[model samples]
Target chain A: MSKPTAGIFGLTGCAGDQLVILNCEDELLDLVNLLDLRDFLMATSANDTRCSLDVAFVEGAVMSRRDEETLERIRQRSRFLVAIGACAVWGGVAAQESNGNHAALLEDVYGPLGRQYDAIPARALHELVKVDLNITGCPIEKSQILAAIANLLQGDPPLLPQYAVCAECRMRENNCLLIEKGSVCCGPLTAAGCEARCPALRIPCIGCRGPADDVNTASAWAMFEEKGYTRADVDRKLRTFAPKGGRA
Target chain B: MSTTIRIDHLARVEGHGGVTVEMEGGAVRGVQFDVFEGARLLEGLVKGRSYEDISPVLSSICAICSVAHSLTSLKATENAFGVEVSPQTEALRDLLSLGESIESHALHLFFLAIPDYLNYPSAVALAADNLPAVQLGLRLKKLGNTIQETVGGRAVHPVNAVLGGFGRVPGFDQLAELRAALAGAAADCETMLEIVAGLPAASFFRAGIAFGALVSPREYGYYAGEEVTMALDGESETIPAPEYKRFTNERAVPHSHAKHSTYNGRPYMVGSLARLVVNRARLGERGLAAMKRLGLRFPPDNPTDNNKAQAVELVNDVDRALRIVESLLEHGLKDEPPVPVAPRAGAGTGITEAPRGILIHSYVYDEAGRLTAADVITPTAINAASIEDHLRRAAENAAPGEEAALTRAFEMIVRAYDPCISCSVHVVRRGHDG
Candidate 1:
């Protein structure tokens, strides 16, 4: 059996997801050996940019004409496309620009200059094209990505955690910040697989991994409001990584 | 006849960008270090965000330099709120930055820059014949990450070091383990230094190019700095950090989402090379020893010697980390919560030497504790103009009308700077065409 050919790409965000993959120090060598890698621009100078692939793992939101063209090219060439990290799975921090005047914003950053390139409000990968699978995190967890890749190679469906971060906190026997300290923790609404990292460390979860499958937006808002957080505060926390109507 | 040389998708660097050079009648007309990544409008987006959320979002600008971004943002925010952190907190923050420097420098030298010197397309290709070297690189990189994860809560964007102090400090045992790890890696560090120092020197040099870096009155450092020292042709001047705009006269260019920055009407250099050139005398005992061992002297003429500078920095950072860990262990770890904050309307600027170069994060906060304005000047944006200057020189020196040779030369020069296009494009203020 031949190895599965793959291409990993990044568009506009922090490039954190890809770095998380590189952060897999112990498994990187073996993982690369398991796949026919191509088009990882951050790690390789020689890329088969136009090569067809069994899977394409795309990170970052599409916020420019070039990103759209790149994502379209990869989508057209791959059998399956996986959206990696919050940027691709849900509009990441870049999507926070959707409510602002993009022209005015661009002017503030680069000044009133005639640009050869075009800038648009950031949109998730699914907003632009079909995403066969999605791995969510502000920067995707190394364990989740490694598992996703291994399962795909074994011809098995990748099993991602469907429960909220609250479940992980519960299993870890961590005290609930929301209930105990009146904190604005988003554990009940955020997806698991981070091992409740922020909450376990005594900091509130900011919902960076996007909402979980069983998230009850209205109920979570009500719960936080009852605990003294304002509706605006709750919305801001929830929408930082995954804004309303951002998910495809 | 006219011709243009293009390396459309520069790989192995942090973001999406390319280089283009145009020539008419065998003379260089124009050259651009274009940034093709979409503008995220982070400055505009960050407005109205709470002070606490600002650092976490800004840190996402570049994964490799997350520590620098977060720490600088915290500094700016703390200044806005008039917050003062404890000495322990300050030490931990410095340790985190050093960890990032070690991680980023090792990754760039071994995985990116070394491949260019060894005539390989990428590190993976190099790994085929040099597996042990690659393994050593990974070991060192993991050591850096271990420190980060132990202190910052996670490897990439830090969640613990907040506005005033850490939400949760590491335990005594954790610090001891990290101390032991740094001690164990000393021999590997020397071996890594030898591998980089022995590489064939990349032959590109132009005398009298300007260099800029943050300056400290204390020891050789990145975290403690309030002013910048500009080195120009054997003469140097110090400018306060708040007066950075005077030196960084940024300009908007049509070819790039990222703007170009010039100092005193000419392109200047930053990052490890610039840091060492300006602060060479402050290269503490360990840095001095490493420079001696590697036969490296101050003010290297070759831009590619940035790789060697990074090798020396790796040794310096590791030695610093060992001392930091020992100091923390001596004082003992505190599970102290973050200091309380009382916000007021104000503006502040935080400048530090990121792994690449100087990174400045300035912000204005409303009385309500939300952001009103924000500005970030990344090292790559400052180096963009300098990179283009080098590219133009490389093109001028190349055989006329040979596209391949010109393209390679241009790519090598750009790679030497290790520009992070993703971090560079998020500038907040408008720029003028210089």
Candidate 2:
């Protein structure tokens, strides 16, 4: 019997999802004992650029050309690769304002007048390589990351519920944002698992849950529009944090 | 024969970034603590957006400090609109900033920097072995999150925490309960300070800085201040943060998205240690007493001292919050919501001491309230050159050519300054380019 090897990598993100893993606090020591930890830059002073591993947990969307290379390198070395956040699952902010003039936005942020650190527009690591799973959220949820890790360790596939936040809101018995608050929400089209935390706070859901599976965006937008939001307003809400072409 | 190490994606220091060290000839040839963590470039994109759109958009710059970002954007908007938050607005914002400090610092210490000193995979490991300290850290972190949620309405990319103070300020009773929690933690903070002081010193380059902090002339500076100066040599000019670019030179190199900054082309320091060094006298009886108990000095250059200094600040902040609550209770409530002023068309510079260090936002707005041009220089950028200088010195001081030794030394310097790459990027390069 051999210990499984694991490496964790982060890209264009706040590193929150990774922190969530670290937030496991005490559970990690016993948990890590089950596997041989390899190449976690945040934890240890000793790390290698390459490693043989059973699992590689990746955070952040592949944004830069260099990032594309890093993503490819991970895919090459690891047996299982899990995309850990919205950035990695989708292109994230690269796709955030994609509907807006991307070229103009790029110019504003990258050049024509901005600082020079030229990069190809952001795209998810999945676009370039195989991503076995996506633990999606703006920064992704900690509980999900923990669950996914447990599943991997158990040789069982993680059951990521493919439902909109609306379903979860119903489960919590909270009032619907659309019906009660007259707020525009992407909850109907966005993924669940945050337990509809944002709408619970009395604020509109900004679609940080990432796009729900096979979401009927057209129907959701039509419903939102019928609720009195104009096409432009509904369009903005759908595109807030969803990936490119993800919105209806 | 010197060995250099590069840390890609420094996890849990509040965003996308990394550092690279270059060793040469058995010495640190040059180091580029580079942050190539792909910039979303919030400031660059907000140019043509409407006044209302700025706060919500920039607030997502980094999910961890979203409230601080929201407040900064709103303050910039207020300046553009020439609207003042009533005193209540100021108070609420101050409280949120305090919240930001607690949350950000706790996260830094517990998740990001602590594992190095304590020898663990992460704070998660420390929770069981060192449950009390970890629990206290989580409690304080939660208090920050709780405050943000109460005021801003949610944590991580908050809204309703807009310009002109909050959409709805907390009532007197709510403020009291919050204060009570802060009060309950006073003894815990004292214990944490003592614990932090026990952490070993981080080896840092010993070049002293002419420390510049917010000397409010009223009280221990938290938010408002016009001009503050260090007791440097006579006749030294006190350059403001608006002039921060000139005082702390900002430049870019090929390896990173973040620009490196230096004070007069040399590294300086900011945040808790720097703040205490500059304003120890005004630290009231409690702060002074805590300082004495902690045994900190005025001319502290070592970055590792920050761990101790943070514990010191945790004490001061909780003390301050409790006092604020008591004062409000006694003084009675009043009707005010961020001061009101005409949206005067002009250029302005607004600087506040974010928990990390001085955060400066300078902008030019048209009469119609458009951010025609904007520049946001976070405290991390200010400390970039200084971090590099410290790394270089730390590496030289290390037994040369040893990557682990060099990394341990460099990591200590970075942890001490607590530079936020999510706010700014740094490129540590070894030697001049070939």
Candidate 1 lDDT over B1-434, as tens digits, reads 88977777788899877887888876888887877667787777788888889998888888888989999999989888889888888889888888888889888888888998898988899999999999999999999898899889888897887888997888898899999999999998988988987887676545557889998566566776778888877888898877888778776655544466777788788888888887778776778888888776556666766777888888888988898899888878787777888889999889999989999998999999999999899998898888888887777777766777667777788899988878886432111121
Tens-place lDDT per residue, model 2, A1-248, is 78889998876666656655654544556667777778676554456668777999888766566677778888999999988877677766545655455556545544442434534566777788887888887666667888888888889999887889988888888777797767788788888998887666555677766678856778887788778989877666556555463522
Error of 1 at B94 (Å): 0.5
DockQ of each: 0.63, 0.25
Off by over 4 Å in 1: A114-116, A216-219, A245-247, B253-258, B426-434
Cα DockQ of the candidate 2 complex = 0.25
Which one wins on DockQ?
1
How far does residue B9 in candidate 1 sit from its true spot (Å)? Answer: 0.7
Docking class of predicted structure 1: medium
True-structure lDDT of candidate 1: 0.84
* Residue B280 lDDT in candidate 1: 72
Residue B273 of model 1, lDDT score: 81
TM-score of each: 0.96, 0.82
